[model samples]
Target: MNQELDSAAGSLPHDNFRCGTVALAGRPNVGKSTLLNALIGFRLSITSPRPQTTRHRILGINTSEAGQIMYVDTPGLHRGAKRAMNRSLNRAARSAISDVDLVVQVIEAGRWTDEDEALYAALVEQSSPRLLVINKVDLNKDKTVMLPFVAELVAKHSYDEIHYVSALKGQGLQELEQAILQRLPVRPPVFGEDEVTDRSERFLAAEMVREQLMLRLDQELPYATTVEIEQFNDRPDGIAEIHAIIWVERAGQKAIVIGNGGAQLKAIGTGARRHMERMFERKVFLKLWVKVREGWVDDENMLKKFGYTD
Candidate 1:
């Protein structure tokens, strides 16, 4: 596609300093998480094929000689706000674009839908500089169509720049990083150089369990399912202990998560623990329990209790 990081750093020294926030905004499943992970060179956000797999404003802090690129990886900005939870997610995504140095609007290559248009309209209302990112270019077979498609996108928004990338395979990411770095404000870094994310250990652990449920359950997934980290401890013997509760919106969904003879829960726990061990780099003991909390996604108080916005 348009593979160029020539301007991402722009004649700057290897130790040039730049640091600020860049909000990655797009529709659900548009590789926003994949792009964030690729840019940061680590897994700060969890990913699955499921829509709304990410519900929070995940930050991935990349501090280098070029300075800190503090990215705010937000959930997809969508129009369907039928549920309180859905509205909350939209709110979080919308809030990310405000008071930010740059906004990178990620869209799938060679296609534009109404949802994409809606998000574009929202960004146009904001004053922050925006870059148009056409992701998943690897999936587009006909390379010739990319030019015309990019031309059409150029007419759609007043973008400062346009980049094409394959977030999954790390194509054109160097260019993406350079483009972002050039736009970041010249200020002191906001986070520690060693820190990858602002989320705590408990928050990331809960997300790991939730990611497992989405991957394993498939169609049996609950609309309002979440993981609560009841206990997280690191023993002196080099074992990490974690107890997480899977909260579902319905009793039947809870049963489905647990599966027949508790086999499903066990399988899900196994998958989650493997990921946990890899993230923590230690032997992990993960305990999971399922509970049904009907209509909790719609209740403001319950939403707050689960670390969700009302």
Candidate 2:
């Protein structure tokens, strides 16, 4: 893995290669991040059972013999974004969709909510070719029932192509990839084949800790918390040492995160460190601390400081 990361052997060998950006657009909890990881064959983005798990625009690159596809996984766009952080997420999602080679609107296999309709309306305004991906098809046991749902959708809206995929099970991905490649223009690959993402290891460190928070914290507590990396250093002995702070909105939340005898914090750190070691391919020693910020979610300046703004 280290050797592949250090080499740049995958380049465009032919002039007919197709390379461009594709934004995975959708509402919350619709499997957009899952689709991205499956397509790129790398777990660049974090995932949980929570809505709005992705808060920023993440770039995952896939380079093959044929072409390189840059996949932008954006935060799920939704309505009634009243909080400053929620609005910031919406801003990131909207900004990501505006400048892309293609837009893939992902939705659940058998259901389309108002948020999906709203996103479709937004995508209709874009000049880029749009594709509708009905994800989580594995959950839909009866395939015949999807005919009418798709029939109604097509009658009311338009898409350049429609595809059904199960991102978790890796179904129907080849055809989707072919369709996406065919629509992209012929150009040289922008990134090397071995490169999986454009994000830094520091940025990914914070995300890995936050993924554990989302999975372990109860309702509403996870949304109120954000992880900040204080230090990430590679030691002389070749081990990575990291110190992180878990910022919450109130003292009560902080206590809950710390738990009785620091059990909760220990669990969170252990989970995050394991994932970091796996992804970074190194030994990771992680330390965590809980802190209160007193409504940082509503403070715009604090949001900017936390790297929420572009």
Each candidate's clash count: 2, 0
The best candidate in terms of TM-score: 2
RMSD of 2: 2.3
The collision pairs in model 1 are 8-178, 8-179
Highest lDDT: which candidate? 2
The C-alpha lDDT values of all candidates are 0.85, 0.92
Candidate 1, residue 266: the lDDT equals 97
Give the distance in Å from residue 219's predicted Cα in candidate 1 to where it truly belongs. 2.6
| Worst 10-residue lDDT window, candidate 2 | 2-11
lDDT of 2: 0.92
